[model samples]
Target: MLYVLVKTKKGTLVGNYSSDKAGCILGRSSSSLVPMAGRKVADEHAHLEERTDGLYVIDGGHRAGTLVNNVRVKEYGPINKDDVIAISDYRLQFRFVRIGNNEEDSFSKRASILPVKSVEEPSPVNNEKMTRWREKIRRSLVSYMDLRRVNVADMDDDALRIFTAEAIDRIIQDHEDIDSEIDKDELARQVLAEAVGLGPLEPLLADDDISEVMVNARDEIFYEKAGRLNKSEVTFTDDAAVISAIERIVSPLGRRIDESSPMVDARLKDGSRVNAVIPPLALKGPNITIRKFMKERLTADHLIKFGSLNKSMVSFLELAVAQRKNILISGGTGSGKTTLLNVLSNFIPDNERIVTVEDAAELKLYQPNLVALEARPPNQEGKGAVHIRDLVKNCLRMRPDRIVVGECRGGEALDMLQAMNTGHEGSLTTVHANTPRDCISRLEVLVLMSGMDLPVQAIREQISSAIDLIVQQSRFSCGTRKVTSITEVNGLEGGIIQLSEIYRYSQRGYDKEGRVRGDFGATGNIPDFVEELRSRHIEVDMNLFGGAQESEAIQDGF
Candidate 1:
């Protein structure tokens, strides 16, 4: 017997085919399957079956062509794994393999012999009624609860009693009937506290402008909006409630956190990053942090509009990308390093194959020829985990034109540098560092983490040769993230890597609104790539490099 597995979006089904049916079988007419003759079979309810290990025919005679996501299968060939078989408009995936001798008997007994049925359809009228009922209940509950009276800051005994009574009334309104014998007031208070979100917390989470949510235990909850961190009037009744909330947030994602695992890093359906740590790991009680990505990705044009870069900086970076310069973006945490990397990646031509490796899949590149790879955490048994170092080494064999490392925090930096030095030009990566000099030292330390005993000078030499540019970003006190410096490495001299400041941000005090005002301009030193740009017939604007006073005004905004 041949073990055959069928998969749909809902779930997977396993079965076996006998030798008599030519290893082919018919599913519901709604399924995605095609006949060997490359024609639609006319009989909608024909019960054609498959034989063991032999090709069988599919009778797909329907209005919709038998195609897998639109590709028409024209032959009765062996089905490969992940091959979508389309019988009509409905689709199914097929995987066929040999059944082991020891498991053949059990597999035959477990094979599903019944014909597949069409998917059940729900009644639209019933669904509409349910939605209306839910809306009505929500409105009634909201009205019965006194949101204005419940103050999270100072809830004395008298205030608690009044709040609890109001909560009970709201709960009674939500339900058709309630048991009088139960402690309805206590239960109501608990439910109301959760639903009303009695403070600024719920509004903060609902606000699309907020990018991050942070809770420092049960007493304080902070949120970041428009890159500025603001304290919310949210508080948990106790540490237990905070832990419970964390559990609920991670539970839907098939993640877990308890005494056995007091910490978890997870993501929500909306691509928001979440991190939670309970007691022992977190001394101040359970804490949760959420970083939300924008609904629309940040584009290069958006960066320019935000005064992150001037025309010269943009043009120079674009040319550097086209010329296959390996660039490194250095910055402290939350300095928009990944954001800058994403914008720079847009300069890459769409025709070249690009591979992106990251701890989390955060970078959103627009190129068509892109392969995104994310690192996986270890399973419960601590097995089957794939690290960034593993992915960095694997990418070298993937025949990529450019390899982008989202951010290098570990030994993966060594592998990434090796890939850059070998043949992967135009590769881009980000590192956590306070300054350009510190970035080199960080690289040396990370390379040592790879278990290679190479001299520090050797690592520095590799970095100077492999990296063409280092772009440093900074987050100001006003929460404005900007590119502070763009330095070009010009090889090493006397055991020190030589770097020239191509573009520097000169702090010119602050504006009337107290926002940072700085001028981003060249330091009068032309880049080594100037000759290369001239060779390509690209004109140089010396005035943009601060040769003229009018040019300073033009570059001040960026």
Candidate 2:
């Protein structure tokens, strides 16, 4: 990887950046990758470009000019890493570092921190020039505090931010030139955000409409809003800066990521999911994908309003959950499985003790009697790893009235099936699958992953008897997620599990506005346990699922 170390006139290392990206624009403007505040630097001074011949420094046609090794040049080398490229008062050195190779570590790399730790810190951020000044001012504040023997560890967040802001003002006034183009107020704000808050992500997280934030590179970003993806105007200073942010996130949770471990799964204070990739694994430079959590907990009514499901499905799920029926939710990534699970979980009576197992705890259950368990990855020493299967096994010992495994991705499926069959009737979990039939096959594969050499027929029988319902969630071309199918596991027939769909979503086509035009219809196949529900004195409107019925209250025209 190509690296750049930015130094001051006094030779203080300020910013460390590295990327194999084609080029970098350096100037006084915020758009420049290495922005300088000095008056001698033009707004668009110079840039570094990697060519077929080699890396070269090209002048940006400014009279201030680009210099390399103390000589004025309109253009410079296929530059060596040892070369020093200078513009204005700052010194820049390029270097290349090699990283270790290990493509097979992807699965273990995504391990999540046990018992997720989240700290609620808030601040604003932006790309490039602001990124540089944020670093400089942040360094200045730390130095000022250190030189004066200030112990900031004991100070509260508000106190520290206030103190840091004052020190930043003093540093700029005493150090930076008066004619420099840097905006002091903006500098102070960015520094404060980086030092005390999430920097750049604060605004994105605060926007309720945005569901996700993607960091592709230092100066490029994207976000999902209104079920559509769009480019974001925000960015970071460089790859190193992005790495720093990733460290800040994983470190607080007692998790570590380095050359040995290059990826991680974490959660924000609001329970938003976080995944970061760096170096050899990420060719585009450091990458971060954040799935933002909702501020308000969603209920069945919300799903109905959003055209995800209708009253009949909600009513059936409520009865099933209350009756202690094991349910397995299936969906592709980000298809609202968790959200639907969260809503369905609420159906359990408050009197029952519920235990939830997850990789990173995202469910927000309001029941007074509830225990949530998050999975743990091995530490730096490669020991004490707690997988989802272990959590499921432990939950069985807790005497939980209801067990909810967040997702059955591995051997946990076997343990979950056993728990469901062995009197943990109301257990719930999810898996990645496209259809109800695929869900059965997925469960069989997950069961085999348990390391037991059980016969295929036995595994099929175990699944058929344990899981009562399979709710398939799907994300459409228009980005709307809906319940595509809700099928009941009737029984094992000729070594195959029989599935009868009680409800399904049929999309005729897309509308003029490109929104999916679909309707949730009843397939007229009632659950095999419906008679048992009636015998137990539970009431259900059987006619609701008698035939093709669309939810009349949908506002999205589904």
Candidate 3:
């Protein structure tokens, strides 16, 4: 069965119908099934119908018009449950309810989790008693938090930790009958987690070794350290607690999370990236993911120490930047593209003016003449939304010596490429791709996203002329991130972009402890960019390309 429900000035109207009829009419005329009495509604305003495929609402050439989800309906389109339908002044949410013999099964099919059978035998539970104690402590902490008004922003890390410890001690000492066997130290940590830090996520964030934290649900948490994921014993009390932590993170930044807007992308005060999604889009409840940033800026030497890349690669990259060659770092997710971008960005002359545009503002460039711009989401009215493309267009007026985008994910790639081709010679950015050739293909796709309808050959010409180098970064199964390849783009040939591999990473299989063993070696192709470096009076070491040249390079401070 199908129905049309609308809220009018008189009252609510719910009418049921079947697909057997041509369609149902909505208007102010007497012939309409659900006649709305309003001047804005035409005599034949709109038509509602249901097909085997889906339910749809079509506009009937009315003056006032029909709208769905704030966008005017051009003709007719498929509608789903909970979709907002507007007719003149009133707004109605669409709902579909199935009737007949299979209704019970339909309801069960829509359920997120299956119900536990009453006759099923229970398995042995691990740490059930300890979980109960933790829940009690969490409840107590929530209660204490309600009566407290501490200025957390004014305290340093040590002061905050001390205050948290004292508060937990007072709460436990005042309620001795709560649980005598509960460990006081453990209780202190839990209280600190709820009161000061993100619950069940504080320890992971504190540990420098941990790189990522993922919250699947209130009671299920996971962390990654050294490229390996491990489930933690810590858990939240409920979904509300998980939401509270997310609110604590994004609210301070003037971002909101609720039914109206349930998804958000934000960054921590320390520049760690955060992405969150809540119901009803996320069936599991609220999900929070945090990508922790380093406390200290990582440099070329740090990469060498971690075996991510050798000295020769860094030296070549430094020269590439110095020679004003546009560079694009390509890699899969979590492959250290941004990290390598940061390392290479340091080579930019301090006196040159630099402009960086990003969604979350994660880049920490230290140039004195640097300008950073971040995109902004719209307000409740769906107005004032500033996108990355808008910022890229505006940066052109700022007289930037070099433009660096945190990452290109959309049509902004077109503007970034245009900016690179139009005298912004030393621009830098990262794109998501697996290899160097894939990077070029991804660029072509992103250029098409601009909706310019240009010829493929024109876009290829723009890409090949603007980008001089593509640095491929990859993360191995052993959690190692390395610069796998660096290819030089040498103009277009036979309607295809020509690429010369200057450096390549060869994997020597995994080591005994499951670490990836790889060595960075030159492909023996002297890059054309070397001549550009020499023209700029930069010294060149031909022997640096030799794999065994690390012996003397260490003495030369490579």
The candidate that achieves the highest lDDT relative to the unseen native structure: 2
Candidate 3 on 1-558: residue-level lDDT in tens?
444444432222221222224367777776775535556778888887776666678888887788888789855556765577787755554444445534433323222111110111112243344456556766776577667876667765434544555656666677677555555555555555665567667657766677889999877788888788887766776788788889989887777888888999898988899999999988998999998888778788888877777778888898789878899999999888888888899899998999999988788888899999998887777788889999999999999999999999999999999999998999999999999999999999998998899999999999999999999999877677888899999999999999998888787677677777756788788888787667888789976565452311111010
What is each predicted model's overall lDDT from 0 to 1? 0.65, 0.77, 0.75
Q: Decide which is better by TM-score, 1 or 2.
A: 2
Cα-based TM-score, every candidate: 0.63, 0.74, 0.72
lDDT of 1 at 277: 93
Query: On lDDT, who's better, 1 or 2?
Result: 2
Q: For residues 369-466, what per-residue lDDT tens digits would candidate 2 score against the true structure?
A: 99999999898888999999999999999989899988999999999999999989988999999999999999999999999999999999999999
CA lDDT for candidate 2: 0.77
Q: State the weakest 10-residue window (summed lDDT) of model 1.
A: 112-121
- For candidate 3, the TM-score is 0.72
Worst 10 residues of 2 by lDDT: 110-119
Best candidate according to TM-score: 2
